[model samples]
Target: MSSDQSSNKKKNNFTIIKDDSTDGHGGYGAGTISLENMSSIIVDPNEDKAYVDMAAMHARSDVERRVKWINDREEVQGGKLYWIVWVTVDKNENGPYYAGVAGSEIRVNREIKRAYKSMAEHVKHMEKSLKGHIIVEHMDDHSKKLLGDFLRDYKPELWENSTEELTRQLF
Candidate 1:
């Protein structure tokens, strides 16, 4: 499109405003996305306490293990799912493709406003998928508790971005 048309498109509808610091190759850094949006912390596969606990639980009797599995799975599915919607300069493109967990909600319109709040021009070509569904497996109480603790203490940034209702449900 012509320069005039491009400018008009931005003015008429929402478009990504590039962040001056963005390196143009997905270098937006972990800072741009809120902590709530992160699906999980990367635990040490071998030495993590949560991993050790989960392994023990998975070996239990069938019925007992099944119940625990279902409850744990619901934690993420029931909470607000988030992703980054990368919109290209060309409006005709199908994406702004998604890059996050499996169950991220695909509805575009619902999250547009929320996404704009944290958006930067470097990512203007892409929109943040603020609302969506995420697919994750069951984790044990130890895992959940560890994560909750991290959020409550180490990663408090998400607290302000999250709604009280979401905080209760997630944490």
Candidate 2:
């Protein structure tokens, strides 16, 4: 395969949903959080689109590439806003669903090679999503719609099985 294809394959691997690591085994990795069910969604309001970009799981999404991170949001003036949403899937009595969904804000300015995002907020959102919390209410309407459409189109069944709160908030 060509270099681009090989790189794409590697990027795709980040989105694979794995089986629970603990699985009630009570040994080795027991009591620890399992990220197997989680995926990252990158929402770009400027593009009016949302899509899964697993590399964001490590702050390496395409928009984040080649940028130095700045803690002070003011430093990244004119930076474009982006949302890194952490979505966790789990199966209930009905079926597999979007159990947890949280969106974190990020701003990037490629021209200045700087980006702004709170590491603490991102970490907190990821943890909340793992615990089945929905925290996208703070996102702008356009971004929310994009996220809702992406989720529904990505997996109709999952969207159907998700809680009404998710649909209500996103819509």
Candidate 3:
């Protein structure tokens, strides 16, 4: 596509925008064909507590033992099935995607929004308490996008870009 066409394309539809601080390799990070709501938080595996906790839960059930633990308070808050969605991101293309899903609902979209806020605080605590751990909680729609906008809105400088593996999972 010509430069004009490319710019026009971006204007017509939502596209993932990546800051080329690290490198221009964030191909899809440049933008995506899908709608913004369909975007996802491309997490850094190194910081993926979900992947780590699954390994720990097998041997021990302690919260300390688990890489990521659902808040007991939140778990018992909404309903019998309450799950929280957690995501991690890096500043560049190199990342490991980690997300946590809980079946619990806090009720209404507002509650879900608050739930995300609480989760963000929880993740900040996790990052501080756990050494060398990078954790972030961003809200993504069912398609997992503004997890991109969130990243952009929150940190325009830290662009992790998108991963092919993460995109493939969407299909």
Task: Give Cα distance to truth, residue 37, candidate 2, Å.
Answer: 0.2
lDDT of 2 by residue, 1-171 (tens): 899967744543327556457667688877776688899999999988777898888778898899999999999999999999999999999899999999999999988999999999999999999999999999999999999998887788999999999999988
RMSD for each of the candidates: 21.1, 4.6, 16.5
Error of 1 at 119 (Å): 29
Q: Candidate 3 at residue 70, lDDT?
A: 45
Q: Residue 52 error for model 3, in Å?
A: 22
- Supply the global lDDT for candidate 3: 0.30
Superposed Cα RMSD, model 2 = 4.6
Candidate 3: tens digits of C-alpha lDDT, residues 1-171? 799967744432222333334245665445422121211222222223211122111223222231333444453344221122223333344442322211112211223322212445534433332222322223223323423333334333333344433333322
**lDDT (Cα) of model 1:** 0.29
Between candidates 1 and 2, which one is better according to lDDT? 2
Q: Estimated TM-score per prediction?
A: 0.26, 0.85, 0.22
TM-score winner, 1 or 3: 1
Q: Which ten residues in a row have the lowest lDDT in candidate 2?
A: 8-17
Q: Pick the candidate with the highest TM-score.
A: 2
Ranking by TM-score: 2, 1, 3
